[model samples]
Target: MPVRALGYKPVYDYRVDQLGDQGGAQGSILVAGTWYCPSMPEPLIEATSDLHAGRIDRETWVAHIAARKPYRLMPKESKDAEGHQRMMCPAEAGKVQCPLKPRSLGRGVHLPLVDPQPSPTRPLKVCRQRAITLAPEEGAEYWQALDYGDEQWQKIYFRPRNSVEGHANRRKITAWLDSLARGGQRPVRRTNRRRKTKPLGTWTPTGHLTPAT
Candidate 1:
C-alpha cells in the first residue's frame, strides 16, 4: 500500500499492524509502522539542531548538506547502534597530519652582526668651536644647567628644526591666528589715517609759517 502510494518506488516499504479501528479491509488495513523511504535522503539532524541554536542559517545548512552530502544512506553495518551514520567529509578527513617536530623554512637563516673595520688612513674631522674647553666654574655651571633643566637646556642649546616640542608650539600659534582670523577672540585689526595740516608756505618773522600777503 505504501509502495503504491509512493508511486511503486523500490526504496520504501511499509508494515501493517492490527489496530482497533480497521475499516473492514478483510481484518485490518495496512498501517505504516516505520516508513522506510531510502530515496528521501535523511536531513542533517545535528546541523538542523545547530541552525535552531542560531549557529547557522537555513541557506548555510543546505549548502553544508549539499557539499558534505550528510544525507547519503549508509549500510546497516556502517551505522552505529543508535542508527546514526558517521559522516566523513573528504576535505576535512583527507587533511595531512602534521609531524611533531615540523621542518622550518628558515632552518639555515641565522642572525649575524657584520661590523665594518674603521679606515686607518682617513681620520674624522672635528670643529674647533665644538672642541671641549672650559674653566672649572664654567664647566660646573654648564653641568648644573644641563642636569637642572634638561628639556629647556636642550631647546636652547641644541634645537631641532622639526621636533615634537617645536611642532606643539607651532600648533598653538596657528590656533591663535586661526581664532583671530575667525573674529572669535577680542584682539582685532586696527586701521590708521593721516590728517593734512596745511600746504607748503614761505616762513615769515612770526613763529608760524604763513603765506606771504
Candidate 2:
C-alpha cells in the first residue's frame, strides 16, 4: 500500500496466508488488490478463503477454480501514460451474460446468462452499469502488473520466484551441513563448541611429566 502511495508500480508476490475479505463499491471484492465482479459465485470467492483457513484441501480449491466461468476485463477507455482505464462489465462486454444486459445474450460466447431474473429485492447498480473507470489509485494496494490468474501472471510470478527460493534454500542447507561437520554448537549462530582436553600426565617428583598409557 505504501509503495503505491509513493507512486512506484511494483508487482507483488503474496503468501495469501492471512484471511481478508476487503471489498469495494458496486459489490466488487478485492483480492490481491484487483476488483472482481459481485456476481462471482460463492465457490469462486470462497476458494482461497477456505483453503487459507484450512477448511479445504488443495484439490477442492483447484476444483473451485475450474468450476468458475470468471468475468474478463475489457478495455473500454484505453489506459493513458498516467495509468487509468475504463472497463466494461461482463454483461455488456459479452464476456459473460446477465439478464440486465440482454444485448449480450447469444453472441456466440460460451458463458451462460444470469439465472433467476432479478426482483425488486435484488436490484443492483452493477446490473445497470456498463463500464467502470479504474484509476491507478483505485486498487493501488493490490493492483497487479498483469490481470490476476492469467497466463501472463503465472509466467511472471512462479518460475522466477521458485528458482530464486530453491537456490537460496539449497545454499542454506549446504552451509548448515558444513557447520555440523566441524562440531558447530549453533550452526545458525556460527559458533562451535570446543572439545574438552586433559593433561597427558601429572608432573613427576623429578620434574618429568609421564605420558598416560
The number of the candidate with the highest TM-score is 2
Residue pairs with clashing backbones, model 1 = none
Give me the runs in candidate 1 sitting further than 4 Å from their true place: 4-45, 70-213
> What is each predicted model's overall lDDT from 0 to 1?
0.30, 0.63
Model 1 scores a TM of 0.17
RMSD of each: 43.2, 14.0
Tens digit of per-residue lDDT, candidate 1, span 1-213: 333233332221112232111121111111111111111222332344455568788787665434322112112235343323332211112211112112212233231111123455532111111111122222111122121112343355455534767899997787667547454566544434475565445334567655567
Give the range where candidate 2 is weakest over 10 consecutive residues by summed lDDT: 18-27
Clashes of each: 0, 1
Per-residue lDDT of candidate 2, residues 70-107 (tens digit): 55445688777667777766667667777667887777
Q: TM-score of the candidate numbered 2?
A: 0.65
